[model samples]
Target: MFDTTTTPDSFARVFTKGRLSIGLITPLEAYPESPFPTLKDHQQAAKQAEDASFSSLWIRDVPFYDPNFGDAAQMLDPFVYAGYLAAVTERITLGTTGIVLPLREPVAVAKQALSVDQLTDGRFVLGLSTGDRPVEYPAFNIDFEDRAARYREAIEVIRTLSENHFPKAETMRFGTFSGTLDMHPKPIHGRLPIMAVGRSGQPIEWLAQNVDAWVWAVDESAAIREILSALQTSALDGRPPAYGYSTFFDLDPNPDAPYQRFYNVVRIGRKALIERLLHHRDLGVQHVALNLKPSRRSAQSVIAEMGTHVLPALEAA
Candidate 1:
């Protein structure tokens, strides 16, 4: 059901126009402290996202199911789930809310992501995270201390795997095949866009140097501005556009509270939501993914409500 009309770079256009294209962080809308969501939830939510006209969907990579950590993503693997979403939903971009490259084999990631890009007509945005989750790295037998270094190397490996038949990779994956092996079925436009999730393993400086776009964590406007300002000032790489994500409690149509929250406790109306959207645009956040989780509202109702209220504010802005 993925659309062939829009390419990965087209998603980038949403940034340049000072426009917003909302997406969801999977488990599709669950609590911050929830372990996992049902696969049925992911399936239904994918359809809802497409039906609601969300520009994209986001998923995260969690290698281990630490009880203390609380959130385990959606138990099924991220790319596998993305493929399922792609098959069922048309036009919405499917992406990793983030993949922790430090613990993963880059070549494997490259193969999986490329397959997804090709099969889904290239609607993939890379929310790549370096993975500071201490428990995950130990479980994977990866060094948490040097994740930043590994992250850079892994990115090189993934990029090479996608762009060339025989790529120069220096990491562990490169050891598997020293000679050339062509990575078949390149993405629709030959590649997917990679956006770094916060300043994961490396400094914000290195992230700006490498990734295509930036997504500041926690939907913090100030954090987004700080990083954006640093990127603008630093000479690391190209100027990058930035975005953020948050979760909503799904307030009623009419006003109750008159303000918003870091956890998205909004005490207001559609006008307040619109005003916030405009403020984010003014603050220079290009996209915001709302985690409709831990809410009193169910996924379907929240998606519908957000579409009616949130999507228009984004589109009109």
Candidate 2:
């Protein structure tokens, strides 16, 4: 969710009301491990997403890697990498596909995120999730079982730190505060937009009550429908829109190849991928972030293909 003290002007253009956006998630490919993205590919991909006219490029925050978890999410500190990506690209918004909330203290996270937001001139949007992997929890001495509660709490703490005449509120789990502590380098817009990763068992009312937007993941068709239904119910004035989606791509790029999806990764041709996304749109997905995970000769190749073959059609879809 976003800060009440902050206004819409503080957000990226994509955060404006009833908007539509398409973005790419990085790593930008399918990998069984965490630390494997090509340094060259990562930099080029950020520019390519912008050059291709995409609205945003999202990077994942995987604080700790659990090999058993099977996916490393490109293994970089998202905020630091975001700083790098911010410097490299001009317009495309930089996002954290998500930062796992329960893995670290909220204050450290908020300070760094604010720094990135300022560096990017307010082009930061954060995706947050209550971590699900059991292995990731214990490493931080946090109970994996109750992360959902901690997740909610972390969101609250971050918001308070990001806004509120800081030195005023005594910090708890995040950090100790003495006086009105204002986070340096305020958001370009005064607030950063937050997209809740999944309901995380928190209710649609809560999602509507909190996050600036909500995300649809995995292959759940009904999930997007449910979110839209809640958006209508949660309307305060003129129906506030809630984003919905499930990321997919033409991995393998072979139409005849038997399609498969793992970790939300899908293998299909560009045409099939478009159809599935359109289906989601019809169901009320206002924004969709593509993860172009197909087994291409290169990540840039997939980005090029999406720009040339997929994006144009989706614009009309």
In terms of TM-score, the best-performing candidate is: 1
Q: On residues 39-75, what C-alpha lDDT tens digit does candidate 1 reach at each position?
A: 5566777788788877778887877788876666677
Pick out the ten consecutive residues of candidate 1 with the lowest summed lDDT. 1-10
Candidate 2 global lDDT: 0.69
Number of the top lDDT candidate: 2
lDDT of each candidate versus the true structure: 0.68, 0.69
User: TM-score for all predictions?
Assistant: 0.87, 0.84
Off by over 4 Å in 1: 1-10, 30-34, 172-179, 218-221, 235-238, 246-256, 262-269
lDDT of 1 at 38: 62
Tens digit of per-residue lDDT, candidate 2, span 1-317: 44335545434344433344577778765443334555546777678878987777878777766667555666778888889888999888887768888787788888888888888878888778875566777777987777777778888877877766655554445556667467766666766677887666577667777787776674567765665777768755534545755475544566445546665666776667677767766776667776654454466777777788777877665
Q: Against the correct fold, how does model 2 do in TM-score?
A: 0.84
